[model samples]
Target: MEVGQVLHMNAGTGETSYSNNSHLQKKVISMTLPIIEEAMTNLYSSTSPSSLVIADLGCSSGHNSLFVVSELIKIVEKLRQKSGHQSPEIQVLLNDLPGNDFNTMFKSLPSFQKNLSSQLEAKDAGPYFFSGVPGSFYGRLFMKKSLHFLHSSYCLHWLSQVPEQIENNKTNIYIASTSPPNVLKAYYSQFQRDFSTFLKCRAEEMITGGRMVLTFIGRKSEDPTNKEAPNSMWELLAMALNDMVSKGVIREEQMDSFNIPVYTPSLSEVKSELLEEGSFSIDRLEFSEISSSTYYNEYNHSDVSEIAANSIRAVAEPLLVNHFGDGIIEEVICRYKEILLGHISQEIIPGITNLIISVTKK
Candidate 1:
């Protein structure tokens, strides 16, 4: 059986998590991939056979994998055709959490391999390879000079571990747990550690001129001094949880146990970090509001319900099931959805998101 199942939510009736927002995903991909492809073409001269390896870190199961994989293969084929070189031995790696549904990812591989092989065979191009490397992206995964191009979409910003302070607390003392000073500091420190690790790994894994294109959620400001407001998304999420607690859908004590497993980096912060690592040069940085048209936005009964349900399945439901207990998930999700539906809209979405930062190795 596939490790993951297709979303059965009907969008109109249930809650939605942000991950199931297909419109958001598509918009981010469209804005980022072109710049990445352009950079790859410029960095790698197509005149000669080049061994190329491309990796997608934090590639979760289901639709995310499907879209990213298709994009990677398409760009690689384009590069090969444009360069008129024998296709390099292609290596694509997908990394994610241990609990991530690799079964769904594996099931999709056969078709991908068959199709790519047939295309390469038709063109008499060199062989292509596909593999899944399952693990956290906070550490190294390859040998020196092993990669030609690297990409990570919507994943790098997550800290390796939730802050110990928040995790250790028995009561809900933090105003907004996700952005607690201690938590943010811990997440930033982890970002520093993991990012440095990423650069060190890439320096060893990438050729001198290899390219890397990364897209992740980023804050617009460089200021660590900014305070989160009550209307902030993080706070809104806190409100939703509070409502669930009041309804007895979830334990009030569990609130402290639930923190978003992510940290949003600012542009200045990213640039400073990249330079510190000295592994790559910034090529382009793009940021924009994701379009809602890419989603099932008709707001009709069935579509809305489906989208909402999928959202819960994609993020909230899974996290609750993992952290709190599966037994309370359905009821918790029901209450959480009620809170979210009251606040979350395609508009008024807090946080400046969809950051695409492209860099080339020195």
Candidate 2:
């Protein structure tokens, strides 16, 4: 299936839209702040570009997208102030698949700019330009040696398409406890190919000394079957679909043929790919577990479960609609909430492992 043309979060600022349900992603950006700050500082110190051309690939439309850009600008402005040098003009490119809700994001830009302007009104910051560039990041999206800084958060783990060989991974949309060993191999191979292409594309697009800070969901174990509910949101989603199938709400054929286009790589796998790609040098690589309940402290257990289900629904509903039509959307989400409520226990509220890597163009 052509995943790019169909895959996107639920559009607009509705109840299930990604814009309102992206608290987990927002928390991730907040958690990784120090790493990003360091990466931007290193890039500026090395290149000191007069015009900072920044691109955020897979920058889905939402507050999180603007949050990332604003943080980078703050870092650079601080750097220029410290050095007493002229501030550089900033060019921002927000990229995603063509199906993204760019209209919603674009409409919010005036407010974003207003807030940014007020914050920097008294400070020495350069002109900030914003534009949307819609496309996949697995290939070239910019001219050669054009980007000075790059960032993507919670995006790289999404494969450009599902692994072709996973047809036999029945009754499951992603890697699950019942998935065969071959399923793991297929997913890894797809990740290798996609990630290599991503590295190569960015290497060509970025100038020497350009830096990238990427953070995406991953797993601590090499065994895909060992991933818990927090990391394998798709697995829970598959369970919900299977429940519908049992109730005759969805066909078995639908469940059997579908596979999520995502892979949760181990840290070693990511490092290996970077080393093999041979274009970028790893400056800082780290893995950490953060609670999925980030920013949900005031929410009760039931509220949290619904929010969690909505988050997954926002990301997966488009894929489901493309494959199964819109008939099953509401029922599947309802069932997904039940599944999440059941799986959530009184334990530590399992944290999702995210790998954060900062690399420099060689």
lDDT of 2 by residue, 108-133 (tens): 98999889878774466778898899
User: After superposing candidate 1, which stretches have Cα over 4 Å from the reference?
Assistant: 1-23, 114-122, 167-180, 223-234, 247-249, 291-297, 300-309, 344-347
Question: Per-residue CA lDDT of candidate 1, range 1-362, in tens?
Answer: 11122111122222343334545555577677678778667766632336667787777765556566566666666777876666666677776666666676688778866775665433655466677886666666776777777878777765665545656433332223334466557657767777777777777877777778888877665643243221144454456567767777677667767665556777777777888988788888767654333343457534444455455455545555556677876655555455545544434334335668888778
Worst 10 residues of 2 by lDDT: 342-351
Give TM-scores for every candidate, taking all chains together and pairing residue i with residue i: 0.80, 0.96
Model 2, residue 266: what's the lDDT? 89
For all candidates in order, the CA lDDT equals 0.61, 0.87
**What overall lDDT, based on C-alpha atoms, would model 1 receive against the true structure?**
0.61
Model 2 TM-score, 2 decimals: 0.96
